[model samples]
Target: MLLFSRFAPNVLLSAAVALSVILAAVMLGLAMDQRWLGLKLEAQPRLAIPASFEGLWIDAIEHDSPAAEQPGAGIPASVASLVSIGGPDQRSIQLTPQDLMEEPDALETYAGMRAFFARQDEIAGILRSIGGVELGVAFLGETQTYSVSPKHQRPVTSLPPSFWMQIGVGLAGFWLGAWIWSLRRGEWATRFLLLAGAGLMISAFPAAVYSTRELALPGRLFSVLSTFNHIGALTFGVGMIGLFLVYPRRLVSPNWLAFPAVILGAWQVVDILQLADGPGLGFHLAVVLAMLAIVVLVAIQFKVTRGHPRDRAALAWLGLAVVVGAGAFVATVIAPNVLGIGAFVSQGEAFLFFLLVYVGVALGVARYRLFQLDEWAFRILFYVVGVLLLLVLDAILIVTIVDERAPAFALSLLIVALAWLPLRDMLARLVLRRAELSRGNLFRQVMDVALTPPGRDQQARWRALLENAFRPLSVTAAADVQDPALIDDGLALAVPGAGGLPGYRLDYADGGRKLFSLRDAELAVELTTMLANALESREAYEKGVAEERERIARDIHDNIGVQLMGALHSRGLARKDMMIRETLTDLRDIINNASNPDLSFDEMLADLRSQISEHLFAAGVKMKWEVESAGPAILPLAAAHTVRSVVREAVQNALKHGQPKSIRVTVRLDEDAIALTVADDGSGFDPSSVQTGNGLANMQARVTSLGGRFNVASGVEGTRIEARFPVDIVRITQ
Candidate 1:
């Protein structure tokens, strides 16, 4: 029941439409058969008065009859001779004057005349052969003339070509009508296809009937059918013209469509009225004009919409349909009349070519998206050119060397293998570069970015890559985002930011020359998802690193720092107490606060001095601090740790190992780097005898890691250590 409700109305309407098409086809067939019917009737036998038949005989005269042998002596030649008639059944007959009075049946009269001729020939032959008796031919003046009439039976096999033509026309109409009915309402192209289909179907009926009119349909039916035939012809031409005008694109006003109907109707009326003396040139002129108009309109459509992928695809298919369908018509129907040669194919077969147009249109109506029609069109173009080249070369080969079709085709194949096949791919690539290649490489690039990670400069890099991909006039973040997926805002694509994704607005794509298609839209969505995934991955990675660093910092401060504090409290000896203090300060600075960068210059210096003084004062060594005009400057966590570690190591080595009398420390800031110098004047020692220890090695490594310079000069005179760190590392504020 549900199915019935959904489909019943359409089924009923389609049935009605099909019935109408069949009726029109039948009518058109009958109409076009009028002339053939007239010729057939005139050829059929009819009775005539014997006076009108005058000197003519009505039967086949026997040559061996005594009357014929004696010529004028036996019987009148006019009475003895007969007339020959040809029709469905061929016959030679004679009629007596009494036949006219009886008004005999044509077939029966012809049969009687035939038997009389045979009997006379038999009697005369017997008499002549016997050589004893003779027979005289008597002259009975025949007042009735008999003509042979055979039963007119038209079997399907023997039906004329026009009958098949009507069938094809009717079938084509149904195909297109069903196609139109299937389409969405209000489609202009649907209307065009229906009009053309209707015209073709309507015109075919009378034509079919006319071709087979020998079956004896009434004469008045022919007159009525003929009138409709002209009307159908005009309608077909108008429909064809209208189709060309509206399809693939609409290039004209709807009002202009009425002109074809009006003009064609006027011409048909003129021809029907027989107002002019010459043949119906006006109807022919109108058709020719419609064809010329079609050519102009097609050119305009191609001109206006060229280079657009969708339009180009539609045009390509439409052109193919025209070439296949129209080419058949011209070759079969038009060329025969124009060149005075037999048709290449029968008109019935020619009608089948018109289905190519319907197929093309069906593809168009389906939107042809699934086919990737742009690439197919390019392939077709290359194929056509290649085939044409092969044909030309083959023709030359046939003329110049190979005179046979087999050899020419073989050589053409070889040429195609060597040249056209390879060249065609290259040509297609050149022509379809933008259509086939642009989006392809872009997706690969997007995938690469997704698989790999773009770092801190990801935004800029992504922008450049996108610019190269789409060749957009501009790409910017949308000020207002409506949808986070992929927004097509007519002029651009707005890909919104989500999670860690950076949003982008691509404006005026392809340098503002072309609009994006559904394929492009889909690609945009994929690319956006890739970009978002890439960004999210980077953000997650950074978040994980930060969390891990914080965890490590807490572990160091809680566990290790407690151990150093305990040691400081337990020890009372100067060196042990100072060692514990320095260790705790180093641990806090290096591990607990290594990732922190908020400390000011004053606080950093104060802590450094306190640690040094505590250690030096315990060792009975003086510590001098010369801190210079260091303003409100600060250091990055890594740089601060490096500086503190280097300075502390230098002072501890001098106080504990070098036994220095005093240590002088000077800190100064330059525009680009901070310079820290520590010098010790103590017991002289030979530097060459001493090998590097872990403390000295560690200080050098720390300074180098911070992208700074570390210098140590040690001799008998004492050691001086200098370290300079770049301002960038510490992020010093003036």
Candidate 2:
């Protein structure tokens, strides 16, 4: 029970850690997938409008019409008061009779008879009425008589409250969704989405308040809405500027474009302050300037998208949005006021156009991915919206077309909506399937080499993969075996067979041409050395086995021969037995130690000391010993074994080579380091002309491998051999 209790916490912690790691991996994979899709989508087409609208005009008012005489029948106060009277060549006159009265007699007649032009649609009505008159209207200084007949214009319908409410909710939902997505990554696109949404909300305020039924707080609401609208306009301008800076090729800097917009926006605020009594000329000028600025901006946008083929589709969609938005705004607001159109149609058309324009702008900025899904989505949106619009407009058109009833238009709209979805879906499926097939085929060819073994046949496969992987970028891979001459053809990828087998190289290119190669010459040399060592080890192992069998046979023969010779010479049995026992014991010990390599250094040292003590006691010589080391005495097994062997050999040499009378062995740590010293009082020889035997050479080699320094000094006073290995290098933890 206690064991289970103690282990449960650790088990739970381990599980938690594993779960966290798995979650992180899944999240990372999802992020990578999204990034991959984004890149693929970026390469697709864009939509935009062409740059042309140089000659267009709309009439504002028809003074000869009965609608103008009716109370509340003239154009909306906002539209009537702001329209310009003169053409671009002449200084613009206000929409007042006083300005016309000051003109010359010939000019006054023309000016008095001229229809006020606001939008393109208004021109038709004025031209119809003035067909018999000799006077002409001047547009950009060109005078021309009306060409179109007068027809009774129709009224525009208002959108339902429910539909607008739904639009508002959808916009709010989109913003919330975007904000949630941004909480994780906060990318530039996400920030742009949030900013655009906020601007839309601010811009919607004045329109919303103006439509409300409540009148008590109308003045306060208007003031608040105007402030918000002005601020929102400024923010939108700044956001566009930022967007251009970030994507300079896609969007031009609005430095020149924004100046006129800002000035006009300020003028609007001043005009609002003066209410209906604002300076008429100043007000009309501001409106004209604002329209011109918008036109210029749209033209610039068209140019940018046209020059870049990759941006064509996205720019196309965006361009449609701008055109529809701007067209709607101009047709409703400017056309009716300039050209003397009927008030009922003018106000209603203006609102409807404004709504359509708003939708276009929203889609352009926030829903770029809709374009990648195929043009079908746009076709669906356009036809569906357009058909419903036509039905609503059919009632107005019927008065001119054939005097149709309102019920027929509503029935047409219902039929169009029902047919739109199926057609859109079928088209989308056909387009997407073709796209998917091409993408899949390209992916398969590039990855096929990774599944196959790499050899001569695979070499071509790898080259194919490389070429396709960097498609539109030319690359060639030459094998060292077949194309040795081409190996150094600028790209230095080492030829595989340049030296021998089992070697390869890589080459990198800048653009389509070879830049440099990375060769594994050092790796090739190391592999060759390893092969040589393996061959040598096998040869030595075979020789060692054969020599061992021969040695065993020789020992058996020598023992038998010695026994026979001893019997003939009558040698002593006891001495022969002792010699045999000693030889056998030495053989057994050597075989046992070779098999058991983990023998401790301290144990070996103790054994050596015991042997030395026994021999010295027998020789009637006294020996002194001293030893010291830090902490618990521990040394690496290899170092310890080597040191012990050298010390024994030195002691034997002292007894046999120098004939020492007494020996003093000191093994103590020097300060914070390990030190071992062996000294003996013996017959010392000359310092020079001493030969180093095979045994001495073998001892030096062993110590050298262990990175220890060995020193031997000989003199008349005494002979000394010192071996020292750094304690720091030799010590090991228990």
Q: Summarize candidate 2's per-residue lDDT along 613-634 as a digit string, tens digits.
A: 7656655667776666553455
Worst 10 residues of 2 by lDDT: 34-43
* lDDT, candidates in the order shown: 0.55, 0.41
Q: Write the per-residue lDDT of candidate 1 for residues 1-734, one digit (tens) a residue.
A: 23433654345345535566457545544334321211111111244544334222324323343223442333343334222221322222232332221011111233443343343343223322322222222345433222222212233333556566666665556454444543322555555556666666655565456434432334345445445655665676677677667766677798887777787788877756645432224343454555566567667777876755455556666656655665566556544433434446544466667666665554543333212232444343344446556766887799789989998988898998898888777765554344554556776666555545555455555666667766777788764654533333234666654444466787655785543444455666666776667657767878977965874564355434644665666546754565565666666665546456456777888898887887787678888899875466766566566667678778867865678888999988666677899999865455556666556776777678667888888877788989987767444575
Best by TM-score: 1
Provide TM-scores for the models. 0.43, 0.32
Superposing all C-alpha atoms, what RMSD in Å does each candidate have to the true structure? 21.0, 23.9
TM-score for candidate 1, please give it: 0.43
RMSD value for candidate 1: 21.0
Q: What is candidate 2's CA lDDT for residue 286?
A: 45
Where in model 1 is the C-alpha error above 4 Å?
Answer: 1-170, 181-184, 187-189, 204-230, 243-254, 273-285, 304-320, 335-342, 367-451, 455-542, 561-734
* Consecutive 10-residue window with the lowest summed lDDT within model 1: 98-107
Residue 526 lDDT in candidate 1: 63
- How many residue pairs in model 1 have overlapping backbones? 25
